[model samples]
Target: MMVEQVEVLVVGAGQAGIAMSEHLTRCAIPHLVVERSRIAERWRTGRWDALVANGPAWHDRFPGMEFAGDPEAFPGKEAVADYFVDYAAKIAAPIRCGVEVTAVRRNPNGAGFAVTTSAGDIVARHVVAATGPFQRPVIPQMVPHSAGLRQIHSADYRNPGQLPPGGVLVVGAGSSGAQIADELRQAGRQVVLSVGPHGRPPRRYRGRDFVWWLGVLNKWDAEAPPDTKHVTIAVSGAGGGKTVDFRRFAAEGITLVGRAEGFQDGVMHFAPDLAANLARGDADYLRVLDEADAWALRNGVALPTEPEARQIPPDPPCVTDPILSLDLAKEGITSILWATGYALDFGWLQLDAFDAKGRPRHQRGVSAEPGLYFLGLPWQARRGSAFIWGVWHDAKHVADHIAKLRGYLDYGAPAALEPL
Candidate 1:
């Protein structure tokens, strides 16, 4: 097999990779993007129906193109995947799909790097791990042994139809979990949503879409103040602007419960603070709203109008409705959907640069390892690192640095496509 030589080798060709590819290409850098599967494979394979991005259409788009839908509305998963495919082709990014990067390490001489892939080896002066946050699904061990009921992580779930007919229990109260529970209940399935400590705020307020707020506050601006603590808090937790529609979930007969604790003998256990947690989340949101309102008041900005507040309905039927104990098996929750979360797995890249947390130690996208860089990561910028609208800003910065380091022009033309 022949070796492939490039100045910069970008791994994972999703939103981040595609955006970075465009930046590199425009800057006239010699780079190649390698993806484990075809572009948007995760969105194509991992997502489910009725899966609209929790964010507004405008906020979920890549650089150069705006989302073609109503800016206030959310786009479904298919639309998102299609958008990415179009972005890739429009930019004419040079990406090799179906190429899995098995390992990555720094060049021993410290000038460049080497990557081992299923296709062949590639040596490059720079490596950018643009693999976004959802690299792998993490399931808690306590769930499997604690409950004898069926269990599936969020990754395996494509839609409510895939769930067991019995009372469907969704663990993890994040955006995905909340949305899944809402859908299950809408489908007439007995749904029980387990609310973890982390809660979500509403996407719309008083008929005003959430994106309106984000824009008014200049959350997307590149020159926004860094000390705005409230904006920081809201945007970081706004996973795709995903939040449960309490009124809809409650009206449709979905029960919100405490966090998933453990499962045993077909029993699932939950902890306390279900109501309190929800209230606290609501209060936090209201607090932020009040602050934003107050700022507008002080600065002569317009006041916010009141939308009908959707409160969590009272006394939805619980899995253990008649005051059962914390154990889930006793309540008869047959299947547990561990919607916990995703983790970024960079373990295969045996560079001794990451902290104990397995995150690459990088100043912005430039890692400590010379010629090794990363971009399109969550929180990579002051804002919008993980979202579609956010990654491009970071990508542009990283792409410039890579180009300067390689002394290449603006277009990403590889000096050689074959390995050195």
Candidate 2:
């Protein structure tokens, strides 16, 4: 068994790992980035073929690297993956692709960590888990074990043609669910979208992208409310900056059902709160808009009075009857797409740093475990911590922390080091 030693080890060569590596290299920190697959594997293989980034290119950039293409346009999944590859090469990040880390545990002397990868073992003074947030798909336990139906997670779904030729029942009304339903319906397949509590932000507000407004309002740094559950935001770039509102799905002949409850006797039960869910999403969206408007007015920022020409009007009430259950075989729903988001998996890491909810206990990227850190997690430090543009900030902090511990000045420090 080959063994190597480094000052730092960064797992997963995605956006987060690459960003962390850049900072580590800048700090003259000896680090190795290991990935189970090629860089940006999720963006390259996990997403659907027609899927485009929810945010435009300008907003979907890393530190020191902006999209060279049209800033207003949203790049497709492949294009985004290619961008990551290019960025990794441009930064000369030390990455070992196709090298999976099987296990990570503290060293016997409590000095650092020992990472056991498929290739060999690596000992590092610091370990940064930059594996990203979406480690595993969150499929509900309510889904039935049916031999007649095909089930696929959003991460595995590539295109409408991959599924069997029949109706599709999307089990979540998040961005992925909405976009997939629309795409499947456009491909001449019937689609039933299960509604859930979501936020339907406009594609563009006041003649500017909604993301730009978010940045202006400083929402990215705003603290999330206490006891807030993750709410999926309904927005998409599949149709080139299109709004994936549930109201429009009803008008487009897509069956809108309530949240999936459970499955029994070849029937899938659902909650009878379709209207309430839609109303909640609408209300949440309006609340955000109101907040943005108020902030703009208070700051004296001029916003366009009229809506953009590309903005589509919200469709009127279409789904009225409360769909309580769906007869899977009878309705000809041959496939189920579970777009219920994802959960973090750190089973490989033998540590007590996780909370009751299995989330790592961290302040920013610094974890409870010394010499350990996490990056690319939703709201890790700010609302955009997991985002391409936001991860850089957290990376810089983690790099500085590691450098300080090792008696090295922060990267790019002056020659004359001041007193600590």
Candidate 3:
């Protein structure tokens, strides 16, 4: 087999990968970017039509290019994909597409890494794994055994047009679930959304975009002393708001259900949220929004508002009307959509240094494994590590640090790998 060598091998040419590539290029670092498919295909293929970004355009930019449109407006997935294509072209970021990196193994002597692809092997001293956290959608075993309803993960869902003719049950109350439920209800599908601890929607804070304020105030920016716990809370609480709120979903005729129980023959059963539990999802979200506002207040930052906030019509009720939970399958509920959260899959990575939860134990993007680094993870620096606009700040830091590493800084030769 022909051998290929590179000084630095950056995997996955999505937002994170592209950002790293740009940084490497600017530093005149010899590097090769390998992507499994067309760049940004994840956003192009995985998202829905009505799916504008969860946040504003200004908050979805990269290192060099700002999103081209109304700063306050949200761009669709296609627009994002197009932006990536143009950005890659503008930067002349070399990317080898259609090469799936199957395995990444550390050199036995602890020098570099071996990146095995379907086509061939790439050896490099420093390996940056930019394959983001949403690589795969996890479907719980509890969902598969549901007796009669056809079940599909939210990843498989493109739009309400693809849902079953019968009423649809959406599991999870995260951002994806809420948006899916809204779309389905708007499409005239009787929709039920299983509630979870979702982040709050900013009803109105100050007079500016909450996300913009977060960005300007450096809420998602990395700090000298990393606050992982604070980072997690910031991101998990209100980093990205759901496209639709419970009130609007309710007004749109979407049923807001409590957490799902085990599925029985064709019937998807749900546990009722107690009187106290009722509207808990909305309350939970509002609490987070309040917290965000309080954060701005405490920090003495001017709260910035969305430009179009006043223009957009008043939201429909957060809850859809006549949205009552009925037994699915038994009650002719034919389909289930799991909008549950996503999990990171480092199973193939085979790192022994992971935490008990299988997460990489690291400060920022530095994993315990030497020469192996991760960037663009959710809350990696702050709440912005995963956001397109926010990733650049983190990527710059990671790339700058990587560029200083002994092996990474060398532009002379690709690190050699021993015989497999």
* TM-score of every model versus the real structure: 0.85, 0.92, 0.82
Q: Could you tell me the lDDT of residue 354 within candidate 1?
A: 80
lDDT of 3 by residue, 61-134 (tens): 88578888677666788888999989999999989899988888876643677778888976777788788878
- Top model by lDDT, which number? 2
lDDT, candidate 2, equals 0.84
TM-score of 1: 0.85
In angstroms, the error of model 1 at 289 is 1.7
lDDT of each residue in 338-390, candidate 1, tens digit only: 88877778876878778876777777777887777777656566556777867
- Whole-model lDDT per candidate: 0.70, 0.84, 0.68
lDDT of 2 by residue, 1-420 (tens): 445877799999998999999999888988999999999999988888999988999888885777777999999988889899999999999999999988888776435777788988777778899999989998887766654679999999999989999999998888889889999989989888888888888777777788887888788776664346778888887767976677677787898888888898888888888888888877767766777778778999888864343343554443466778889889999999999999999998888789998889888889999888999988888888878888888899899888887774334653331111
Candidate order by lDDT, decreasing, is: 2, 1, 3
Q: How many residue pairs clash in each candidate?
A: 24, 0, 26
Model 1 misplaced stretches (Cα beyond 4 Å): 145-147, 218-248, 299-304, 307-330, 407-420
What lDDT does candidate 3 reach at residue 21? 89
